[model samples]
Target: MRYVVGITMDKRGRDAVSLALTLAQSTLTSHPVELDLVHVIRGVPPEQAVSKPEREFQKLCLEEAQQWMAKTHDLIPKTIHSTTSVHFSDSMATGLIDKATERPCDLIVVGAASHGPLRRFTVGSVANALLHSSPVSVALAPSGYLPPSRLTRLTCALGMRPGAEVALNVATQSSVLHDVPLRLISLIAFDARSGAAETTDAASDHAKKLLVRASQSVDNATEVMVDVAHGRSIESAIDTLTWDEGEIVLIGSNRLARRQSIFLGTTANKMLRSLPVPMVVVPRFPAPESTADDDISI
Candidate 1:
């Protein structure tokens, strides 16, 4: 598997590298894991000429970026193949997305926004932009995150939304590829008591049907578990669920997103407030209209 890691000169950047390393180490595939560590800097337009002082400043920035990249590269174990580069872009998110697309990477890994609680994720400008526009799946590392000894499980946050099945498929494929257990989770949040039971039950039933579909997609030896978490809000519902030390969450983009693109929905944004583990936001896949037949209520 190939991962494009957005590296900065801060703790958040180190946190991203840590999470990426854990993923690389835990993958069970025969092919070697590769990491592309990229650092983005503000660069003058190719068509524009620069003054001597501006040229000197640019040279200094590049040298400093390369030095930091070298230090970050040394942190990765020799077992994993890795490379470092300095990219020229006005936007950090844009540069990372371009790198991921050019490399055809399986995922883009980045750290959480800096100003957040120690163990939780706060989406910053870069992550927010990537969530809405990245071509590939984007992984967010929580603040102060450290790599676990190994990944314990893979969880798919299944909902009645349009891209729910796409998220399920991606999570299932990852579980099979990495030889990890898969968990299908449905989160129910209700505001009033008027029809909470009916709503919750209907959601649970739909999740079970999705579970059955996921079971059919995997081999007999693969273990698949399904459960539903309920609360007054999405954050509370997420809090009710138990998470393993190395478990990662996978969720799909909103229906409004362009086909095969990512757009973070409101539910996911709420979940992030309380999510202690890393989360991967997947892009919506192109499918027929009939695909949402069983999930029309939501």
Candidate 2:
């Protein structure tokens, strides 16, 4: 799998790099994992003409970007193949989208917005743009997140929605590739207006049926666990579950998304605010199947 990781000269940038490496290394597939470390020079197109002084300033900026890239390059170990480049575009998100499209990468990784609690995600402007516009899946690293030796588990948030299959497919692929366990969770948030026992029982029964259907679709060899989490709200339901240090969550894009593009709904945005681990937003449609040599690019 090839990944396009957005790089900046801040803590967020380092956090992104850390998560990308952890993800790349965890996959034990025959196909090699490659990372394209990219930094964008926003509001500056490469071909635009300018005065001599302005040109000099742009050159200096490019130099600084290259230096930063070099430092990031050193952080990557020999086990993983990586490349660094600086692109000029109107916006950081635009540059990243362009780069990912050019490479036809499998995933794009970025750090959460600053000013959030450590180990939690806060969507920033660039992440918001990608979630709404990018054609590929996007991964967001929590603030101050530092990946463990490698990922140990993949938890897919399953719902009785149209795009749920997409999330399961991606999570299963990752689980099989990494040889890790996969957990399927159904969040049931009860209301005060209803009979608590009846509401809980009905929701639990439906959630269990969904879990059975989902589990039957998986390979028998895969270790799967299913649960129905109940709470007053989605956030509280998620809090009731224990999270592992090396765990990553997978969630599907909204059903209202374009055929294969991503659109983060209100529920997902809320979950993002409370999630303690890194989250991957799967697109509405499954990625096209291809061999490593044919479709995978730098």
Over 1-298, each residue of candidate 1 has an lDDT whose tens digit, in order, gives 6789999999889989999998888776574579999999877633342677777777788889999999999999998999999998879999998888774477889999888789898899999999998777889999999898888888888888665877887788778766788999888888876588998899889988987888888866478999899888888888889999898888889888888678998988988778899999887862233124222100
Candidate 2, residues 122-235, lDDT tens digits: the string is 789999999997788899999999879878888988777666867876776677777788888887777888677876677667667756665665556467787778789889
TM-score, per-candidate, Cα-based = 0.92, 0.92
Q: State the lDDT at 206 in candidate 2.
A: 66
Model 2 spans > 4 angstroms off: 45-47, 195-199, 287-298
Local distance difference test, each candidate? 0.83, 0.82
Specify the poorest-scoring 10-residue window by lDDT in model 2.
289-298
